[model samples]
Every structure is written in C-alpha cells, then in structure tokens.
Target: MLTFFALVHQEDDSAYGVQFPDVAGCFSAADDMEQVIRNASEALALHLEDGDLPAPRSLAEIKKDEDVAAELAHGAFLIAVPLISFTGRSKKANITMDAGLLQAIDDTASARDLTRSAYLASLARRDISG
Candidate 1:
C-alpha cells in the first residue's frame, strides 16, 4: 500500500478537481465531496498501471514546491489518497474463524461474483483507506 497527497480545487459553482503532485498528469474530478477520494484512487491506479512508479514525496517536500505553494495560496487544499496495488498473484494464508461466519462470507462473495479472497481484500482496502 502507498499513499499520495492530492491537491483539491473547487472554484465557485464548479466540481471538485483533484491532482496528484507526486504522480504527474494524474487527476480526477467529482461533483460531490464524497466521491473525490474514490475517483482519485481510480485515477491513480490507472495512471500507474504501466511502468515503475516514482517514490512518493513527503508532505514537507511537496509543500516546499513553488507551484504547490502558489496553489495553496489560492485556496486549494490537500487530502491523503490511498493507493492499493493489485499484484495479480495469489498467496495462501491460514486463519481461523467461526464456521458460520466463514460460510456467510463465502455466500456473499459468490453472490457478488467475487472469490472469497477478493471480497476480503476489498473490505480490507476500504477499511484501511477510510
């Protein structure tokens, strides 16, 4: 898991706009505040899908940037956006849980057309990001 600092801008009567300073050219937009993080995460994932991603800069470093400083001066704000990598490799693990609970998880996953591991991973990502 990695996290990026996204600068958000909202002009009068306009949608919220997000741009990742660490990942150049990566951005997203949303009409509602609640969608900003989710949309930004998706944009970051797509933007990083191809090659090696550069290391994320620290907040202090980003804040020191002249461009970022200018944006901050104009009312833009920052938000932390979590990046989850889908490695496409499977790993096996052993855990103990109540049999009924396990069965329920499996049933729910099946209903959603996802494997148990995928369902659990999604839940973990959401919890961690939130």
Candidate 2:
C-alpha cells in the first residue's frame, strides 16, 4: 500500500477540510475527527481511479514548503492516508492453509454471497484503510 499525506484544517463552526498536497484537485471533508481518515481514503481512491497516481512526498518534505509551514502554524495538521489500488485484473495464486480455516472462510463467503477472493480482498481493504 502507498500512503499520501493530507493537510487538514477546521474552523470553530465548520466541518474539517482536507487536501492532498501531492494530488491536485483532490479534497475531502468530514463532520468530525472520526470520519477524517475514512473520508480522506475514499476521496483519494476516487480521485485516482481514472488518472495517473502522483508520487507521495514524505512528512519532512511536505513540511518544508512555506505554504504548508504557514498552514501548520495556523492550526492545520497532517495525516497519512493509505491508498489501495485496483487494476481490474486478476492472476492465479496457489497457497497452503489449514483445511478447517479454509472451510470456514468458504462457508462465510457463501453466506454473504461473495467469493472467497472477494471476501478476503474486502477484509484487506478495510484493515488497510482503517
């Protein structure tokens, strides 16, 4: 997973605002702190879905910018947002696992009307993003 840094700002009576310094035109807002990471992750995924992804800079690099410095001085903060990319392609993989665990996974996937692969992918995405 690749991660990008987001600059977050909030006023006394408004929702929290977020912007990706490395990704132009990508932004998100959340009503509270709990939503910040999730909302930012979704916004970043959508923004890059149809475009080339930009290289993410480090915190030290972003902090060096004069504009970012000013923002930080004015109560803005930074957060790391993880990016999960999907290429719309699949490849075969062979793995060894305990038979009991495999059976449980298959049964749960069947109950949810999802394939084993899809269920595993969803779990990975949720864990990585949150």
Candidate 3:
C-alpha cells in the first residue's frame, strides 16, 4: 500500500482538479466534491500502469516546498490518497505472532469469508489509509 499527497483546487463554477506533486503530469478532475478522491485514485492507477511508484514525502516535508506553500497560502489544499498497486502476483512469507491473536484473526476471517492473509491485508490497508 502506498499513499500520495494531492494538491486540490477549484475555481468558481469549475470542476475540482487534483494533482500529485510527486507524479508529474498525473491529474484528475470531478464535478462533485464526493468524487474527487475516487477520480484521483483512478487517475493515479492509469498513470502508473507498469511504472514504478515513487516514495511519498511526509506532509511536513511537502508543505515546506515553495510551490506547495504558495498553493496552501491560496485556497488550494492537500489530500492523502491511498494507492494500492497489485502486481497480479502473490508471494508467500512467514511471520510470528501470539497464539491468542492468531486464533482471533482466524475467527474473524472465517466470519467474513476471507482467509487469514486477506483479512490481515485488509486490516493493514485500512489502518494505513485511515
């Protein structure tokens, strides 16, 4: 899971526009406020197709930049967009955990019709995004 900071702006009577600072030439737009995040996510996915994603900078670090600071001084704002890039391949790994926690994870996964790995991955995604 990866997260990117997007600069968002909207002019009077215009659609909202979003751009990723770290990803040059990648952008998206939506007429409604509610659709901004979804549109931006799709735009990022399409732009990054078969391309390596650059690591995201911390919010503090990003805000320190002159251009971003100028945008913030105006009406523009920052939004965190989670980017989950799946390579269409899976790899196995091993880990250690407490027995009680493992049992609880198994029970929850069974109730949700998900495997332990799936459940854990979902949890990680939610945690990072949230």
Q: Give the winner by TM-score.
A: 1
Those runs of model 2 whose alpha carbons end farther than 4 Å from true positions after fitting are 11-15, 31-35
- Among these predictions, the greatest lDDT belongs to 2
| lDDT tens per residue, model 2, 57-115 | 99899999888899999999999999977678987778789999999999999999999
lDDT of 3 by residue, 17-101 (tens): 9999999899999898777877787688778977887878999988998999999898999999888665678889898999999
Q: Against the true structure, candidate 2 has what lDDT? A: 0.91
User: In model 3, which range of ten residues has the least summed lDDT?
Assistant: 121-130
- Lowest summed lDDT across 10 adjacent residues in model 2 is found at 121-130
The residue pairs that clash in candidate 3, if any, are none
Model 1, 7-102: lDDT tens per residue?
999999999999988998898999988888888887888899886888988899989988888999999998888887667788899889999999
In order of listing, the candidates' clash counts read 0, 0, 0
Residue pairs with backbone overlap in model 1 = none
Candidate lDDT (C-alpha), each:
0.88, 0.91, 0.86
Error of 3 at 53 (Å): 1.5
Cα lDDT for residue 122, candidate 1:
84
